[model samples]
Target: MILLIDSGNSRLKVGWLTATEDAATQTTANGQTAGPLMRREPAAVAFDNLNPHALGDWLGTLPQTPRLALGVNVAGPERAQGIHDALARHGCPVRWITSREQLLYLKNRYTEPTQLGADRLVALLGVRSRLPSAHPPYVLASFGTATTIDTVGPDDSFIGGLILPGPVLMRSSLARGTAHLPLANGQVTEFPTDTHQAIASGIAAAQAGAVLRQWLAACRYYGQAATLFVAGGSWPEVEQEMQRLLKQTGGSPNTHPTAYYLDRPVLDGLALIAAQPDPLSF
Candidate 1:
């Protein structure tokens, strides 16, 4: 069994994959295809913080102890180190995912490619694995604490990208940095009629608009219309807005970006990396 853990800023997405030769067909309780032949095993987990103790607890719940556990963490070095230490205690081999300088048909151009966020690298890696020959390159956008846009050129080079404040952060900044704005939970359904909705919607619009603008600019700068991918915690709220803004700007709405909610891109990337060895195994 392989344990793929994706530790994000707000939550963690854990996926379990088991390898066995059971010819018997299986199905989820809901009758969804789930079995070895189908390449699926209904996996579950408990919600926990980025704490090692919480992660350890989640690991303990697995049906069988994992022989290999790979993690993709975006919480910085300190948190990643802590999670690594805890996983090691369970005797399950573990590795932290890293950015690729030249792998999966993609070359990283960051001054220090390794310094790029593991989450971003892993996400792009997964994108590249599927798009080995995609024209115009791949554009990855993660909507989290801060929304990020990373461009992998048509030739598979990490051409770098831009970042802007996320919707939540933008709203919080306005509520905190300004006095007139009252702190309100981000729950505006549509454009608000009052000051609260006005502020929240404005923030959402700015974040979504920035993402749309940056993606278009990246397409122009890269000389190819790249495939856009969007992932994050609060993306559902702003995804429509992003699509709307992109279409309004004459960009193809279908190419606005695809949203991945439970995706642990780094973990998926790690799974891919583990399948093949590279310069940096970890």
Candidate 2:
């Protein structure tokens, strides 16, 4: 078994995969279709700091020790070191992933490819591999601690993307920067009458607006409606607002753009990468 880990700013997501399985025969337990190599459900743990004991306890539940371990870390150098140490204690040698100029059929368009986050690149690769025949100009909107709307051209090149503070981060920033925002805790509405609702609505609108803006740009660039794939922890709230905005703006009736919700895109991407003949060569 190959272990895949996505150590992001807010959580640690881990999964196990077996590349030997035929893609045609495998089914994902989460109701979403399984990728070519994923063999089972992934597990997630939230963390504000690196806790090796907690991670080790979770690792203890694995069916068996993974023969090969691979991961991508956006949690900084200190946390990366901690993860490396924890994996070593569990008898798994880890190969942490980094952004690359080219991998498989995908090409990176970033000015400095390595400066791009591995999570974003891997997520694009996962989506591309999962829907190889999908019409291009694709937009991937990931709503985690920081929201990102990344684009892939018709040629499967990772063009670029937009990033902004996510819902919780936005709320927190407002509370911290201002004297009396009180950290918004209310529902999103079309016309928010109070401060709490207004803050909630504003945050959702900002995220939704970015997604729609990118979708429109992708459509124009590709000369056709582009597909929008949403992922990450904050996707549910962001998607709800996106749908509402699309309806309000009448952007869906004629365009009929496709949208997919991927529950564990990072894990899926890591699994696909691990299945490669030389997983670490990249």
Candidate 3:
């Protein structure tokens, strides 16, 4: 089994897959069959108060020992070391993934390719692997601790994108930065009357607006409607608002773009990367 880990700022997501199954074909939403195949459900653990011994004990309960372990860590070196130690205690050495100028058919367009986050790069690869060869340019909006909207061209190039504070972070920032912001805690509304609802509404609008802006930009750049793939932990909180915004800004009557909620896209990408002949070499 090949173990794939996506260690993000807030949590760690892990999945196990057979090397052979990773190469097997399976149809995706775009009707392609080249995406990564998971042999088991992925598991997540929050970073707060994380206990490596508890994590190791849980790893020990898996059905079988993974022969190879691959990871993309955006949780800093100390947390990465903690993950390595946990996996090592269970007899699996980790080969953490890093950003590269190029990998497989995907080309990095960042001025400093290595400075790009590995999780973002891997998510793009995951989208590419699942999409048909003729798929249009696409945007990936990840709503985690920090929200990121990355663009991928039709030819599989990682174009530059945008980043902003996620909903919770936005609320926290407002509460801390200002004297009387009370940390918003109510459902979003079209026109909020109360301070809490107003804050909630504004946060959702900001996130939705960013996605719509990127979606429109990708469409303009590609000269066609582009797909928007949404992922990350906070997606559930903002999905409805994002969908509403997508409909509102779709422009032409006949040119509404497609949007999909791809669960654990980073992990999906890591699994595909792990299947490569020498994934660590990149």
Candidate 4:
């Protein structure tokens, strides 16, 4: 078993993959098809925080110690060190996954590929590897400590992407940076009459708008059916808003992006990478 961890800015997603010699015959639980090396990922994964105990407890509960623990961290070096020590205590060797210039037949187009976040690259890999050939290009929006909207080509190219403050950050910033915005707790209504609803609706609109704009850009870039994939903690906050926003512009079935929710995509990506031969560097 290979343990996969997606270490975010303030949270961690954990999963386990049981790989066999006959990887060629396995398919992911999502039913998304991939190459012969592709295999099934854990049906459920543990979502935790930066606390050492949660991680230690989860490790203790594992049926067996993992031979290797692979992770991608956007939480900086200090936390990485802490995580390293925590896992080291459990006898699991740790390997960190970083962005490489090239991997899995996909070309990274960042001005410097190494600067790209490993979580983003890996999530894209998860989506790309399993995406059916029948679907067109797609946009992946990861909502976490920071939200990232990435556009990928049908030909396996990492075109480009944008980043913004995540939903919770948006509300928290308002409370911290402003005098009267009290960490809003409200719903996303079309016309928010109160401050609470206004703040809530505004955040949702910003997130959904950015996602839709990127989805539209992908459509323009590829001139084909483009799907919208929303992943991460804050996705539920804006999922409905995004659907409603899409309805306003998507007059026909083919005119707008069809949305799909991905569960712990970074872990899925790690599962795929775990099965494939190690790249020269990661």
Structural similarity to truth (TM-score) of each candidate: 0.77, 0.87, 0.87, 0.87
Off by over 4 Å in 4: 20-44, 133-135, 253-256, 279-281
- Residue-by-residue lDDT tens digits, candidate 4, 183-239: 998989999999999999999999999988898898888987576777888888887
lDDT of each: 0.63, 0.76, 0.77, 0.77
Model 2, which residues run further than 4 Å from truth?
19-51, 61-63, 248-255
Give the distance in Å from residue 197's predicted Cα in candidate 1 to where it truly belongs: 1.8
User: Which residue pairs overlap in candidate 3's backbone?
Assistant: none
Give the winner by lDDT: 4
Tens digit per residue, CA lDDT, model 2, 1-282: 777778889877777675444433222323454334323333232333336566767677777877777888998998788877777888988888899898678899999999999999988877776665545678888999999999998788888999898888998999999987888888889899999999988999999999999988887888976777888788766666787666565455754444567766777677777777888775
* TM value for model 1: 0.77
Q: Could you give candidate 3's per-residue lDDT for residues 151-223 as a string of tens digits?
A: 9988889889998998889999999999988987888889999999999888999998888988888888889
Which residue pairs clash in candidate 4? none
TM match of model 3 to true structure: 0.87
Off by over 4 Å in 1: 20-50, 185-193, 251-262, 277-280
Lowest-scoring 10 consecutive residues by lDDT in candidate 3? 40-49
Which is the better candidate, 2 or 3, if ranked by lDDT?
A: 3
